[model samples]
Structure formats: C-alpha cells, structure tokens
Target: MTGAPITADRLASLTTYREVVQQPAVWREAAETLAARSDEVAAFLEPLFALPDLRIVLTGAGTSAFAGEVLAPALARTLRRRVDAVATTDIVSNPREMFAEDVPTLLVSFARSGDSPESVAATQLAASCLTSVHQLVITCNPEGQLAREHSGSNSSLVLLMPSATNDRGFAMTSSFTSMLLSAWLALAPDQDPRLAERLAAAAEQVLGRPDELARLTGRPYDRIVYLGSGSLGGLARESALKLLELTAGKVISYYDTPLGFRHGPKAVLKDGTLAVVYLSNDAYTRRYDHDIVEELRAAIGSENVLAVSAQSDDAESWQIDGVSDVDDAVLTLPFVVIAQLLALRFSIALGRTPDNPFPDGEVNRVVQGVTIHPLQP
Candidate 1:
C-alpha cells in the first residue's frame, strides 16, 4: 500500500507539518513587513548607533531565546558593536548582573505570541535597570503583551511579524525564522534588498525535496546531535530543541559548536547515535566545521553522519541550492527549514502527533507557569 502525498494541504491534518511547509511563503511576507517599516526602524536606530559605546542585547525565552543566540554574533559583526544574546529567563532571575554595566543598551526582544511572562518582565527590567535602554520588539502577535504594551512608547519600536507567523501549532515553525529574518533586515547595515527573496527561493527548494531528510527517519538511531560554528552554533542549539519538542523528549538531542563538542560533549555519541553537522559558509569557520564532520563520521560510521550545507564540498551532504555565497547568518534562514522538516518526519515516524506532541499539556505553545517576581529599581 502507498501513502497520501505529503504537502502543506495534505498535511493540514497536522498543523505542525502545514506550518513547516508554509514558512517559505511566510518569509516572503516577512520581508515585505520589514520593507514597509524600514524607515521607522532606521529613524529609531540611527541615534543608538551613533552612541559609540552602545550595547545591543537580544533576549527571549526558550526557542524564542535561541533566535537571539543565532542573531547576536552576526549582528555584532555587521554593526561592529557589543551584541549579546541574553535570555529573558536569565534577565528576570538576575536582572542586576545582566544589566550590570549600565551602558547605553538596545534590547531586541523576539517572541512568537509575545505573551510569555518573561517577555514583558524582561522589558520592564531593562527599562528600570539601565539608565539608557531602548527596545525593539519583534513579535508575531499584534495583540501580545510585548506588542500591545510597547506599541506607543518612545523608547521602543514594535515590529509586528506577518500575522500568519503567529503559529497555531504547539511548536514554533514559521514564527522562529520570520522573527529572525525580520530582525536581521531591520537592524543589519547595508542588507541586500534581495536577500529575503533569495532565502525564500532556497527554502522553497528545500520544501520541494523533503525525501532526503525524510529518508533519515527510517534509520534505527535514537539520539541526534547537531553542531555548527559561530552563528550556525546558535542554529545547532535550535535544531536540537526542535527535535526535542516535536518528539516530546522521547528522542534525545544534543547541540554544540564544532570545537566545543570535542571538549567532552562528544561522549553523547554511542551505538544508537546519529550526528548532523551544519556546515559553515566562512572559509575559516568551514575548516573547523569540516573537522567535526570527519570526527563524527569516524566515531559513528560515515553512514550515520549527515552534513548539511549550501556548498557541495562534502559528497555526503544534503545540498541546498538557489542561494549563492550567502553568509552563515543568511544561510541559517533556509538551512533551518531542513531541521524543521526532519523534526516533523521524525515525529510521525515515532507515532507522535506532529500537531500537539504533548496533548496532555506537558508543555505549551506559549509557556505557562512562570511567575514574574517583582523587582524594585
């Protein structure tokens, strides 16, 4: 017997699958939102850029927090400033240390629903802790606490993601990349206006050929490790989390930078382990990334390792074309689509519901049960 064809429409039975496939189209919409708000974003940021000592901090919680991790290094390089990816979870619990320096700071918050407890608390914490702090709220929900509360404030700018990105599924699929892309275009200097189009084109190509990633699901491996370097390091962290979330933690996933994995974390490899390397686009960084791929292959057999890359340097890679010579940061936009597809296929393979892996509410679409302890400035 054969199976029903897999498509955004055919997969409508599972919102997660639908959203995963819909991301490329949604990203094109995200590009338009940033283009429409480009002037306002610049008017709000130019003065902050002039302050030579400005510190840009990106913050969020859980998967949302990972968005900051991916963007921080790339943005720091582009803007040439002290950019840090600090989680809102870290800020609420230890606002003082997180805001210790009291330098002029720009806090960019990324959220899907924007209603998470830490999302609002961290913004308030930044406003009170630092003498000079500005905020850029990049979120999917227009009515979320972050968007609603910060909409009119002179000290901040609110950039609403394409509303379709307010993902309805239990996990964040469209929201993650859209918010990441929106922030990059709005804040990065001299961004190619065509980058988003390129990203969409690449992602569409990935969405077109899901069979390679789907084939990995047939393997007997139960543990997966994702590794990359620099900005791709953050993408590694996110890819790990996506698998964990979609699998309801039934499958173990680990993440680290290629260099850091050698420091002891490589022990996660075993008989049932599979390693996925997210290759870097930088010639220098690519060397370290390639080293780890070879090491992982040696430890877990060549067939158990998969190299994901935009370049075809590796004969064993899952190649993504349509994007040419993009930076690792930009490469992340489409590469992540590969991760999202794998998680979806793996979830179904494990007899899990891709729509709501935790039907019992073990976890939620928007986090629950985080109490915001009031802090006095």
Candidate 2:
C-alpha cells in the first residue's frame, strides 16, 4: 500500500522544520528586521559594553542554546564582551559556577517558546542571585512568559523575532536562525542593514535551488559531520542536532570547529560519509576553513563532500553569495537554511515523517518532566 499523504497544512507547517525549500522569505525578513534594529539595541546595551569587567552570558536549551554557541565567539571578538553559551539545564543545576559573584552579567537568552521550565527558571535564577544582572531576550513567542519578564522593567529587554519563528511544528527551524540573527545584530548595529537585505536575497536564491540540495541529501550516506569556524561553529552543532533529531538517529552526526576537527574527530569520516564545511568570508578565517576542506577532500573524496560559503568562487563549494558583504550575524540565516533543508530532505529520504520523526517520542517540541528548583543564595 502507498504511504499516507502529507497534507497541505502539514507541508506548510513543515516549513517550521528548517527545510530550505520552505519559507526562506521568513528567514530573510528575520535577518533584515534584526539588522535594522541593531542601533536601538546597541544603544540600549552601551552601558553594558562600557563595563570593562562585564560577563555576557548566552543561555538557552537545544537549538536555542546552540544559537549562543554560534554567537559567543563573534560577540567576544567584535563586542569585546566575555561571553559563554550555558545550557539552562546546566545553569539550573549549578548556579554558582555559571553566575559568579561580582560579575556584572548581561544574560542574552534565546527562547522559541520562552515558556520552557528551564528557560523561565534560568531567568529567575539570574535575577535572584546576581545583584548586577541584566537580560536581553530574543525569542519568537511574543506571549511567552519569558518575553513578559521584561515588562515594566528597564532592567530587561526582550526582542521578539519575526512572527513566523514561533514555529508550529516540533523542530525549531526558522526560530533558531532568527534568534541568532537578532543577537548578532544586537552586537553590531553600525553595520549596513543592506547586509541583511543581501542575506535574505541570498537565502531566497538558495531556496530556489531545492533540487540541488535534494540531489545531495538523496545520496546514500550513513554518517555526517559539519565543520565551521567562529560563529558558524555553533551553527555546525545546531545542524548536526537537526539531522540527528529528525532522522531519529538512523544517521550518526557530529559538529566541530574547522581548526578543531583535525584533533581526533577526523576518524569519523568514512567512504560513505557526507561531510559539510562552512567556509567563512573573512580572508583570515577562510584560510583555516578552506585549508581543512582541502585536507579533508584529499583524505576522503570530493564526491562525498559539500562546502557552503558566501561566495561561489571555490569550484567545489556550494556558493551562497551575498552574505559575504554583510556581517556574520546577517549571514547566519542563509547558512542555517542550508542545514535545515539538508535535515528535512534526509528525514524524508530515510522514510521518517519530518513532523514527528521519533515515533516513540523520546523528545517533543517543549521538553517535559523537569522539576523546577528555586535558586538559593
């Protein structure tokens, strides 16, 4: 018998799964909107930046947390802020180490729902224990309790991402990229908003070529590794997680920084492995990213590899032009869309439903069964 049909509503909601073929415009709008607000956010954050000893904490769970992973390095280098991506689960379990005393912290929280137990708890923990803690929440859900935390309080700022990011399906597709873009722009407002414009245009261009991605995803591969440098390193982690989650573990996945991949993780690449590398546009960073790709290509083979980049100049790379002229923050969307589409295509090809890949339900849209504990002084 033929399999059940994927309904139009289901297909529409699948856009929320992060497939590049779906809703690229939503991704673009998010990048543009966040970039346009860079100045306003930077102005609000000037005092925090002025503090020489301030600690910038980026907190979230799953993909939300990965957004921080992508932003931490970029923020550290650009804004000169001491930043770290701490999972809320870790923060709630051990508060002292995550929030050290005498540290003036600006907690940048990324949340899709803003209602997760750990997300709300992390915010409360920061407020209760840290005397000089401030918050800048970037989330898709406007009604999320986390968003309301800043209401009537100048001490907190919440930037609601594009409405579409409040992804209806289980997986966090657009929400992740949109929140990441907001935090990046929040750090670099002086850059041109057109960067975001070009990025959105680029994403649309990539989405136009779903058949190209389909060919890649349709290929037979049992293992996947995503490599990136700087902010894109975190993007690698998120991409790996998406493939693993959506495929229900049929495909093993890994993520690492470009330079860090040579350490001991290179052993995972086999004859049938699909390895993806994120090439940076910056000349300096690109050297490291491209060198690794060249080394890996010679070690493995070109047929089993894919390279995503801002420029198509590299003959072997999937040229995603436009974002190179923009800041890394604005470029994040197109880069992430590539990963999202790969995960979705892989899921469908593997005979798993993209909406609910894990039929046994080991994971859900909002995580469950966690006990909330109050932070103790």
Candidate 3:
C-alpha cells in the first residue's frame, strides 16, 4: 500500500503520524511566538550574555537532549561563545561533575513536557550547585512543573510554545520541532525575517513526498542507519531514536557521522540495512557525505541507500527543495520531517499504533518510576 493521506480516520488511527505531519505549521507558529516575545527573551538573556567568563549549557533528556545537541554547535559558532550540550539525565545523576560553584552559568533547558522528573531535578540541581545560575526554560507544556516553578523568578525565564505544539501523541513530533525552532530564533544574533517562511515551505515540500518515502520504508529492512556531520550528526541520532521509539525497538537502528561510521561502526551493515545519509551543504563536509553514499551504494547496491540533500544529482535522491539558501543547521527542521514520516509509516506497516506503540507500559509518554534522591551535604 502507498502512503495514506492524513484524513480524519488516519488521525484517529495514528495520532503520532498527524503530529509528525503538522510539525511545519507548528514551527511557523513557534517562530511567530518567539518573534512576538523577542524583546522579553532578549531582556532575560542580554545581561547574561554580557557577563564575563559565562558558561552556557543546553540541556534536556531523551529527544529533548538531542535538541541541545542539534543547536549547540551552531549557536556556539554564531555567538562566539563556549556552549555545551548536556543531558538532564547527566545532571540528575552527577550534578557535581557537570556544574561548578564559581562559574556563572546559563542552563537552557528544552522539555516537551516540563513534568519529567529529570527536567525539574536538573533545574533545581543547577540552581543549588552553581553560585550564580540563570535558566531559560523552553517547553511545550505551559502548566508543566518546569514552567510553573520557574516563571516570575528573577533568575529564570520560561518561554511557552504554541498550544498546538504540546503534542498529545506518544512520541514528541510537533513539540520537538517547535522547541528546536524557538531555540534557533532565540540564539541567532541577526535573525532572518524570512526563515520561518522558508522552513514552512521546505517542510511542506517534504510532507508532500510521503508516497516516495512510504515505498522506501515498505522494503523488508530490519536495520536503519542515519549519518550526518556537525549539527546534522545530532539530528541523525534523533532520527534513529524516532524509528526505535515508534517501532517499540522492533527495528534495530544506528547513527553516526559519515566519516565516523567507517571506524568499526560499519560492521553493522548487512543485506537488510538501509542507510539514510543527510548530505551537508558545505562543500567540504558534503564530500565526506558523498563518499559514504557512493561507498555504501557500491557495497550494498544503490537501492538500499538513500541520500537526503538540498542539492542532488540523482533523481532517486530525497531532495529538500526550496531550502538551498538556508543554513545547514536551519535545514535540519525539514530534514527531520523525512525521518518522522518514515518512522510513522514503518510503525503502521508493522501493525502497531503510532500514537502509543508500547501497549504493555514498558515505555511511557512521560517516563515514570524514578525516585529522586537528595544530594548529601
């Protein structure tokens, strides 16, 4: 069967698919929200940015953590400041190692649902461990603990995303992309006025090509590999997780940089593996990406390897049209749509509901069963 349009029945049957398809619209709303509240966001951040020897930490758990991974490299370059992407899981587990008492720090926390135990714990732990600490909470849930506890505080600012971005599905789709776009807008020094429009256009183009992607996923592949570089490497990781999460771990997945994959990780490749390479726009990085695609195609046949790029020579390549001028980091917003759609399609193909794949409760929308321990004085 070809890819199905997201009709009312599809929405009822696969809510996760709907969330995935609606991300481009959510991204536009998020951009508008950030643009409207730009002054407020700036007021909270400008003073912190001026501080001498300040440290910036981008943090969250799971997919939220990947958000930081995707943005940290580009933000550091754009701001000419030191920025680190750390998971809230690391903070909650080892706060002492992750934070210092003397350094002034800005913890940019990304959370789809602010209620995650690690999310709250990480914020509180940062506040207690650092002598001077400020927080920027970017979350989809306005009523979530992360938003409610930190709002109105002199040291912290909470930016709630668009209402539709607070996704109801099992996996985070709109919430993830929306929060990602918000961070891009917040940190970019010279904002591009047309970026949001370009992102929406690019995503709509990808969304319209679901039949091609559906046919690709229709193959009986048991393993999926995603490869990229720099910020795209982080996106590759997130893309791997999307398939794993939606499939309830039925399909094995791996992610790495195009160059790094040859270092022992290439052993995972076999007859049933599908390699999805996100080609870089930079001439230098694109060479490595292209080399890998050529090597993989030669070794495992061209049909098993897929290349996603803003520029492509092959007719089979999944080209993200209308975004050639956008920065590669910004292009990740549309690149992710391909991954989301593939995961949703694979989930349906496997006879699982994309909304909530794990019926046995081994995994959950909001993680549970963790006991928060107090730090010893």
Off by over 4 Å in 1: 1-10
How displaced is residue 129 in candidate 1, in Å? 0.6
TM-score of 1: 0.96
Q: 297 in model 2: Cα distance from truth in Å?
A: 1.8
lDDT per prediction? 0.87, 0.79, 0.87
Writing each residue's lDDT as its tens digit, candidate 3 over 304-325 gives 9989999855566788877876
Error of 1 at 92 (Å): 0.2
Question: For every model in order, what is the number of clashing pairs?
Answer: 0, 0, 0
The lDDT, on a scale of 0 to 1, for candidate 3 is 0.87
Clashing pairs for predicted structure model 2, backbone only: none
Q: Model 2 Cα displacement at 208 (Å)?
A: 1.3
Q: Model 3 reaches what TM-score against the true structure?
A: 0.96
